[model samples]
Target: MGNSNQKLQEEKYENVMKKFKLKESLQHTQLGMVRIYNLKDDNNYSIFEFHKTATTSEEAKLMLTHYKNRKCYNNDHLTQIFFISEQHSQILCQDQTQFIIIGEFFYNNIQNEMKNYIQKNNSFPEARLWQITLQIVNACTYLETNGRNHGEIKSKNIYIHPDQSVKLIEYNFIYGSMNGYQKALLLNDFQYLAPELLKEVKAKKSSPNIDFIKGDVFALGLTLLELASLNSCEQYYDWISKEVHTDKIIKANDLLLQKGYSTLFTNLIYQMISDVDIRPRFSDLKEVLSHFENQINNNVDFYSKYQMRQSNQFNIYNSVYTQQYQRPGQINQAQSIYLPNGSY
Candidate 1:
């Protein structure tokens, strides 16, 4: 009976894939090889193919339910799930049964864009960095407020919309971390995993009262640091993961200060990368970021006025600082403002 049922499920999945034509292989992602598919309607969809080996049939059902429940979150920053399918046995004689998830196609992500800057040996301007930070924090705040958490918040999962605003993809916990054992392994990406999460994994049990929301904040903090430094945190992954076993504090603040970031921004990032217990909640981080954005706008306006008044005497300053800078479509870029160390 089980063999017959498994065959039926595999047939169903094959039929679903038959409706779409493979466009191109994008990249090898954690979920599997991400590919673009053209449906009969002429719309392109992003498809993720992974295996259910790490999860049982019941757990897979729960993940399917959770994926469907994503419809409840109508926020613009979260990716929309187009279709999902699961099979009980490996149709291709692979290690385990396959699970396929499809969503709208995104052209780029932060990870890929950051690579360009890294290759060019340039860092993102402070204003631009703050803009990206604000969007992701807003998205995380919405998730938390709605009584949910996204454990896998990183550059690869953050998709860039054509308008320049960001939308978060790869809801890891919703699918990958359904069970405690699976969650421990899933959270093992040391570059973005919070120190407390490391401790939980080491102890082989999650704390009954763990605040995964703060864990998300820590991951975002590390990602922000990568942007500020224009470097990957992979080198320090070992150090950060071992932080749970020592009394040392990671001086993320000093790193940002050396990179010429503002004290306000650096301090916030510091708090985020610090211990999970001390990390600010998304709500608090959102408030601080909003305040920082207002300060930057006010500073730019004041400088523009000052430059106009002294236009004759300070042509160099006016020429350098009075020019408008464009940000992503979310907010208008302000005219030239003084950025330390030639950040402009």
Candidate 2:
């Protein structure tokens, strides 16, 4: 009876694939080729990613398991995985011996969005940065509540929409970590890794006894710092690579502070990137973020002034410092204006 049921299911899947005509091979991703799925509706278009590597089997199985067991994984912040049939695999010209996993399409990633934003607007706005950070934190909080660590949290893996919302992609790393798959870290991955995690990587420990959640927090802090500084991860990594592990966090904190971010924001970044014993958990970090949010929203005048000063014409000192520069022997020096939170 089970064999007959499996045969029937395979046949159904084959029929569904026949209906999904492949429009074009969009782009090759880390997993496989992303293609445009033409559903025959002129107005409606869908995207499906095809991974044709046998190495992705474990990751594919984990995705399938999540789809079958965890309904909460179907949230908007995550990309939904769709099962691909043998016929679909054949249409995509995938290897017969490989495993194929198809997923929903993402329009663009945060890195691309950041580049575009910087090109057009010079820099990302503080309010928009807060929104993006909050969205990612919410996603991380959801994963944390579900007892899962994201394992990898970087800008490239984060998809962004025009509405300033974000969706996290690439859960294969998380699945690999959870299953003890003995994965090697890529050079790009090192930039976001916590100092302790980097030590484990350097020590060549196959399965290091490190807290994955804390590691993620560290990565999150780095990503947030990158966004806040309007700098790329590669740039930050280039700077930190020259420094020792003990100095990396301090240098990163100093760089963000030098970028003219508020003390509250910079201090939060410091805590997030602190050593494992001192790092703030997602719950505590959420409270800190909420307080900042409330302070921004509750004070309409401050919020308006903040928005107005977002232009390059306004200097950082004008916004953060209360006192103005005094020339030598000046009788009427500019008076200091008190700011919200007392010079934050």
Candidate 3:
């Protein structure tokens, strides 16, 4: 009976996948197999497929309940969800169940963005940092308000648009409830985990004792630090594994300052990566970001000066500029500020 059911589920999943025209094999991420597919309507979408061992029918029901009617996906900073497997078809198997997720296709992620910056020996300005901070904080806050926590928040999980806007991606819904697969995956990516989370894992705790929302805050701080320093998290594996000590944090903070980032911005990164109890809530971070935004609005000349420096460093001879490094801080007092696209 179990074998028959497993075979049936596989057939159903294959039939559904056959409907879409497979474009290219993108990459095998920690989440699952990500591929580009074209719908019958000729629209391209990224499909995320993962398989987990099927223990019971309850698992599928829980997944469907969570994926369906999720209001968090509507936020602009989050990767929008277009389709979920259980909504379209009942895809469950006795041995392994397959989950398919279709969402908007983004061209670049923060990880690759960092690589580009590093290759060019460029660093993010304070204005650019504020833009990313505001958007990511809003995304996290929305998820928290909707009663969800993105257990993994890292550079790779963040997509970057040509305008320098970012969207947090690859939210594993099975993180807290169904722990077998996601828990194992997160444990493997330990550099991004908060200190409290690391302590719990080291003690082999069954569930989290600390708020996962605060954990997301810590990860966000580290991500900002990486962007500010033009360094990847992998480069700071030793420091991150040690719970982000003052020495390493100070080094990164000092690097940002040397690159002309304000002390206020660097200081917030410290407070964020600090111990869980010392960490400020997302609201607190937003308050700081608002202050930073005000500073940007009031200091248009200062921001434009930084942009000029950036442009000069990039190319003085070329008449046209690449989309990635195009001037984002060229706002005037008469124009709306905060984001290049006029989004707050």
Query: How would you encode candidate 1's per-residue C-alpha lDDT over 144-177 as one tens digit per residue?
Result: 8878776677788788876777887545523644
TM-score of each model, in listed order = 0.64, 0.66, 0.67
lDDT (CA) per prediction: 0.59, 0.55, 0.59
Encode model 2's per-residue lDDT on 1-344: one tens digit a residue: 64575566677766656756777786533334466675665314355746443324455565545444443365567666666432212325642323344555555777786788777866555566666666677677777777776666778778765444687764552223222112324342344667677667667676789887787887887777777766755543432343224344445554553545544454556666666876766655655566456644443232234322222232323343222221112111111111213222
Model 2 CA deviation exceeding 4 Å by range:
1-23, 26-30, 38-45, 51-67, 70-72, 82-102, 173-191, 235-260, 290-344
RMSD of each: 10.3, 8.8, 10.4
Better of 1 and 2 by TM-score: 2
lDDT of 3 by residue, 133-195 (tens): 778887887777777666677887788755567876535553224332236334544557665
In TM-score terms, candidate 3 sits at 0.67
Q: How many clashing pairs per prediction, in order?
A: 1, 0, 0
Tell me model 3's lDDT, rounded to 2 decimals. Answer: 0.59
lDDT of 1 at 344: 15
